[model samples]
Target: MPEANIADRFDLTNWKTESLRMTAFLSPGSPIPQQNWWEEICGSPPEVRSSQPRTGVQQDEGLFGDGNTQGRLILAVQPSRIDWLLTVEVVPTSFELPSVGSFSESANSFAQLMNRWLDVSPNLQRIAFGANLLLPFEDVEQAYQSLPAYFPLNKLDLKNAQDFNYRINRPRNVDYDISDLKINRLSTWSVMTFTAFQFTNVGSYTYSSAPLNVAIRLELDINTSIDFSGELSKDELPKMFAQLVEYAKEIALKGDIL
Candidate 1:
C-alpha cells in the first residue's frame, strides 16, 4: 500500500482561530460616528451598544451577532486617536485537519466586507488586518527533535538551545511587508508570530510525561496603507492571504530537516 500523505499523518487535535480585525486610521480633524459605522457594516442596527468617557476622550462600541452565535462582529471608535476598528471571529465545533481552501473562502469574504467598509468611509487612511491560529500537537517531543532534520546546519541551528526562538525577514522580490517574524518554544508549547506579507511555518517541541500535553500556536498579522484610487484590488488580497496560509501549513506538515 502507498504511504499516507504528510498532512494525513500529522494528526491535528484541535484548531482555533481568532477574529479578523481591520483598523483604520483617521486624521485629527476627522471623526467617525460609532453608531452609524456599526449600523452600516452590520447591515442593520446593532443589538447591543455602549459608550464610556475616559479622561478627555469618548469611546463607543457595538456588537452584532449572526443569530446562531457562530461568530460576531464588533465596531469600536476612539475619539482620542480618531480610529475605527472592526473585529470578526469564528471557531469550529469539533476537531479537524486544516484546510487551505476553507480558509481562503473565509478570508475572501472578510476582504469583501473590508472593501465595503472602505467604500463608506473615505476619511479612513491606512488599514491593517490580521488573524491567529492555535494548533495542538500530540507528539510534542518528537516534533521538536524533527526540526533539525528539516532545517539542517547553516540553514538552521539547534545546537545550543532546547527551546527555539528567532526572527526572519523576507528576502528580496517578496510582495508583502513582514515585520518581526518570531518563533518561540517553551516547555509545553511553541508559538510563531509574523505579519501577513506572506506565511511561513515555525514551531517548537517539549517533552512531557503522561498526563501532560503540548501544542503550537500561530499568530499572523498584515497591515498596509490602502490606495483608494484602486491600486489594491479585492480579488488580489484574499489570494495572497490564502497562499501565505497554505504555505505555512505545508512547511509544518511536510518540511524535512535533512
Candidate 2:
C-alpha cells in the first residue's frame, strides 16, 4: 500500500482525467432504453426529488441512494441510450480506520461483489448509458478500506452538500431549490449564486442526520425585497428544469448513482 497524501483530500485528479470521464455516444445497438423493462424485472429503486433553500432561493434536491435508501434514487439517462459521468477519487493506502477499526481486507471482496451484481443483475444496468463509480483516496491506498461495513451507504453520500466550507453552500440559503427558479433580473451582475451538496466522514460514526424520507419546502410571496421588473424568460426556466428532472429519473432507475 502507498502512503496517504494529506494535501489531496481525495485523489480525484487522476481518476477523472484518466478513467471517470468518458463520452458514450449513442449507437444503433446501444442498450439504453430498455432500462424500464430491466427495472420491472429486478425491482430496483426509483429516484425522488426534494427541495433545499439557500439565500431565499429554492432548488430541487436530486436523491441518490442505495437500494434501501430513505428517499428515492435519481438516475441519469438518454432516449436511445444512457450515459454516466463519474468523478471519484482513488483510495489512498495506509489509511486510518474509523472508530470501529480497519476493515482494509474487505475492500476487494466488496468490489467483486458489486461487479458480479452488475453483471448478473437484470435491473441494475438497464437504464444507464455507462456508470462512473469512483474509489475514494483512502480506499485505493489499502485494498479494502473497511468504511462501508461500518458506514453502510456512507460511501455513496455526496460530500459537497454536507460540508459548509465546500461549494455546496454556494447559494447560502437553507430553502433555495435551483431547479424551480431562475435569478434573471441582474443585468450587470457581479456575483452569481451557486448551490452544491457536500458530505464527509468526521471523528465519529457517520450517519444520515436527516432521514431518507425527508422534504423541505419554502414559500416566496412575490413581494419586493427584489424587483421582478426585469424581463423573465418564462420559458427557459422550465426547459432547463425538465432536462434536470429527466436526468434524475435515469440515474435512480439504473442503479448508476454509485
Candidate 3:
C-alpha cells in the first residue's frame, strides 16, 4: 500500500519500473545448470560461456532476452556462489526504460523462476532483489522540495540545485515463520535525464530525431544482511522477495529507512 501511495504524492500521477532483478547466491558445491535447463528456463537458447577468469570478472555470465517483454536474465557464476539476476522487459526499442509490469509482478516472476532453478541446485546462501522506479515531476522544482527536510543538506544551498543525488543504507528485519531475517536495505534517489536515438524512414534511409526524457529515479538493493553457514531451502526465497518488496515501498515513501 505504501508503494501505491507514491502516485498520490511526488506531484506524479503514475510510476514506472525498469531493470528489476532478483539475485540468488547458490551454495558452494551446488550443481551447475546443464544446457537443457538453460533452454527450458530462458524460454529460448541462452548465450552461456566458460568462466573467463583472466578478464577478472568475478561472475561468469549467461544472458537471455535482450529486446524490450522478455526483459533480461543473467547467470553470474562466482567462485563462492552463483548469482541469478533477472528482469522481464523483452520487446521493441523504447525511449525510456520499461516497467517490470509492476512492483509485485516482479516479485512473483522472480520467485517462480527461482523455484524452478532450485530443482537443479537446491541450496541457497542468500537472496537479493533490486529495482529501479521512475516518477516524473510536473515541474523539476517540485523534486527539490520533495527532498525530506531531515536530509543533511542544511548547509548546502538547494535553491539553485539542478542535478541531485542522495542515498542511504540501513539494516532491517523481516518477520519470518522460520526466523526473523536480517537484511540490508540500500536506497538511492536521483533527478536524471534520459536520451535516446530516434530514427524515421526517409526513402531507403532513416533520419535521426534524438529524444530526451527526465524523471526521478529510485533504486533499491535489498539483500540478506549476512551469508548463512548452513544452506537455505527454496521455500524461503519467495517470502524473502515479498518482504523485500514491502520494505522497498516503505523506504521509498517514508524517504528514510526507519
Candidate 4:
C-alpha cells in the first residue's frame, strides 16, 4: 500500500453508515441445529430457508426482520464461524442510508444482540467487527477531485485515475486485558461512480437501471490476530466489542478531517 499523506480535509456532510456486523469463529466446530440457534436469538421458530452446497464454506443463512423496516438482520453460519449482519437490505431494493438517529439506534440494537449471543455461545477462536459507510458526492467530477484528500493519490492526475481503491491491513496492539494482544485492522475505501440497478424478486429476477451516482464508500474490519491460537472467553466479548468499536470509530472518523 502507498503511504497516505494528508493533503486537504474532505467534507463529511451527509455521510452515513451502510451497515454494521459482528462475527465470531469457533474452530473444530460442529453443526448445531439451525432451528435451535435461530430460536435462541429470535425466540421464535425458524422461518422458511434453503440448504447450501455440500462443500460450501459458509452455510445456513436466515434473515430476521419485518418488511416495514429499511433493513434486515442476517444470521449466517458456517461450520466454524457465525456472522450477524445488523442493518443491511436483504436484496437491496433501495439506495437509502440510515438516518443519524436510526444509525445510532441500530448500533445499540446490534450491541444488544451481540451480548445476547455471547451469553450462550462460547469457545471462540477469533472475533471480528466491521462497518460499511458511504459519503455521497454531488457529481462525478467533484468526486474525482476529492479522491486525493483522504487517499494517497495526490501525486497523480485524477483524469487517469479510474477504478481507484486504497486498502490496508496491519496489526495494532490493543490496550485490553489480554497481554500483548494484537488486533488486525483492515480498511478499504474508494471514490467511484456507481450505476444502480434494482433487482426485483428472487431466483429469477428483473432489473431496472437508475441514474448514475457517485460517492465515497468506506469499509473497516477490526478483528483479533490469527497469530494468537488461544480462544476468547464469552465474558471477554463485551469488552472486546467495546475496544473494537473504539478502534473503528478512530479510523472511520479520519475522513471527516485529514
In order, the Cα lDDT scores of the candidates are: 0.41, 0.23, 0.60, 0.64
Question: Measured by C-alpha RMSD in angstroms, how accurate is candidate 1?
Answer: 11.4
What's the residue-level lDDT of 42 in candidate 3?
Answer: 59
Score every model by TM-score: 0.50, 0.21, 0.68, 0.72
Off by over 4 Å in 1: 1-16, 33-35, 53-69, 80-102, 142-154, 157-163, 168-189, 192-214, 225-258
The true-versus-predicted C-alpha distance at residue 93 of model 2, in Å, is: 33
Judge candidate 1 at residue 251 and give its lDDT.
Answer: 38
For candidate 1, which ten residues in a row score worst on lDDT? 180-189
List, residue by residue over 1-258, the lDDT tens digit for candidate 1: 122233332422233433445555664456555336656765777656666655334444554333222245556666523343334332333223232222334444555665666666645333445544444445455435434432322344333335454333221122543332221111112433212221133343432222333434444444443332223333444444344444434333433211
Candidate 4, 1-258: lDDT as tens digits: 132345444433345657778988885554543334557777765444445757444333344443322455667776677887756543445453332213334555566667778777756878888887676777766666765556443354566466878787756887755677788888887875666677665555787776777777778898998887776756787888877766766665554222
Error (Å) of candidate 4 at residue 123 is: 1.0
Output the worst ten-in-a-row residue range by lDDT, candidate 2.
215-224
Q: Which stretches of candidate 2 lie over 4 Å from their true place?
A: 1-24, 28-34, 37-42, 45-73, 84-258
Could you report the Cα RMSD, in angstroms, for every candidate shown?
Answer: 11.4, 19.5, 6.2, 5.7
- Give the CA lDDT, 0 to 100, for residue 48 in model 4: 46
Candidates, ranked, lDDT: 4, 3, 1, 2
Clashing pairs in 1: 149-256, 149-257, 149-258, 150-256, 150-257, 151-257
The digit string of per-residue lDDT tens for model 3 on 83-187 reads: 666654445466554555444455456667765765565467777778787765555665555554324323234565777887878887667654656788898
TM-score of 3: 0.68
- List where candidate 4 sits over 4 angstroms from the true fold: 1-13, 27-35, 51-69, 90-105, 151-160, 197-209, 255-258
